[model samples]
Target: MSARDGLDADERHLLVVDDDDRIRDLLKKYLSRAGFRVTAAADAGQARKLMSMLDFDLMILDVMMPGEDGFSLTKSIRARPGRQTPVLILTARGLPDDRIEGLALGADDYLAKPFEPQELLLRVEAILRRAGPRPVVQRRLSLGPCTFDVERGELSRDGKPVRITEAEAQLLRTLAKAAHAPVDRLALAPDATDATGRAVDVQVTRLRRKIEADPKNPRYLQTVRGVGYMLAPDE
Candidate 1:
């Protein structure tokens, strides 16, 4: 429950993106009281604007938006470079297939509409724990021109903070620990969820944007084709 100021840089900043005003306000208030710097977005457009304007540690996106649904938006983020933030999909769909679709689009977690706030808090905390950013990094790691601090989950270049998606942070931590070993797509799925192979591919695509200088021909995070995915040498 720590923050960047008094706590650590590893503290999480949350964005709650939903079309429903009541849900958004409630989540923002509740998450704030739980020690998160939260922002709200009514739709994909506003979420895009907020993304353009600020950095969020994690994003909670509603699947049923007006134009750009959460899946579509997740696809857009996956397509871009330097934006690998972690995403959690919130929807009424409890179907495994529906959850798979959201995960395939690069969402890290999924929760149904009638979910408990405490459970939501737990999920949020779990995602943040993966990245471990906010307070400060205890160790320093070098990745090409950029650097990642595993303990703090912060990535920086030349002493300047570089914005990375929460997904990116999670990937970096995962790959960093594995070093040169390849991490399977299934290995990246949310702890308690059953995710399909397609879902893993989406997460990898989104992660490449933040980690690879050339997402098309990634050097650091690489694909093993049939074998699965692995982290290229950090150097």
Candidate 2:
């Protein structure tokens, strides 16, 4: 698969979760054409059902659902062994806290509402490349005043222990890997689903609440406008 919009196009399986049929079907078609096998869910509950029924290489989860939102489902999936399956979160709230929240939830990446499909493709490729067993330094990161240990699945500061929800850890890990460079918002989206850059922005903002000392003028996570996300992997 060729890389475009700074997103990669590796062939893979993707699961999309959203309440809206238009978004779900649109993503299913877009991702499929992008060289991925796509499955879809209307909400977290449906996503859970699909998870129980089948295996997907990647998942795209919607944050606001009727019940059992994306964050909840991500936590549940994080519990299973080797279920470290990558996830790209979807949300309408672009607040920093919300972005941080999704990262804290174990999502591989995220996308905000009103995003471009081409951007989503790029984001998917970035995640897929980083996940591969290459010597590339895409998966380790540092947040201000703290360290996010992706391999061990832990977040800490000054060697002090911090409790991270499984979902949060996943988000942190995803950003951490791309700490060396600015990971585009599109690259942080679900491989199987389509969402906007604004949504990814929200998830990043939420992650800051847990890592950065100040969410505003963040010291660790920084935004690269018209591009994607940049994580300061170390102090």
Top-scoring candidate (TM-score): 1
Candidate 1 residue lDDT tens string, 1-235: 5443343433567888999999999999988887778889999888875564456788999998898898898777665443378889998878899899989888899999899998998888777777655533236677666678766668886778878766656656666555666656654543315566676677678766766688999887788776567765545
Error of 2 at 35 (Å): 1.2
TM-scores, all models, native as reference = 0.55, 0.53
Q: What is the lDDT of residue 87 in candidate 2?
A: 88
Cα lDDT for residue 119, candidate 2: 86
| 198 Cα displacement, candidate 2 (Å) | 44
Model 1 lDDT vs. the true structure? 0.73
lDDT of 2 at 23: 91
lDDT of 2: 0.71
On the 0 to 100 scale, the lDDT of residue 164 in model 2 is 68
RMSD of 1: 10.5
In candidate 2, stretches whose alpha carbon ends up further than 4 angstroms from where it belongs are 1-11, 133-235
**lDDT, candidates in the order shown:** 0.73, 0.71
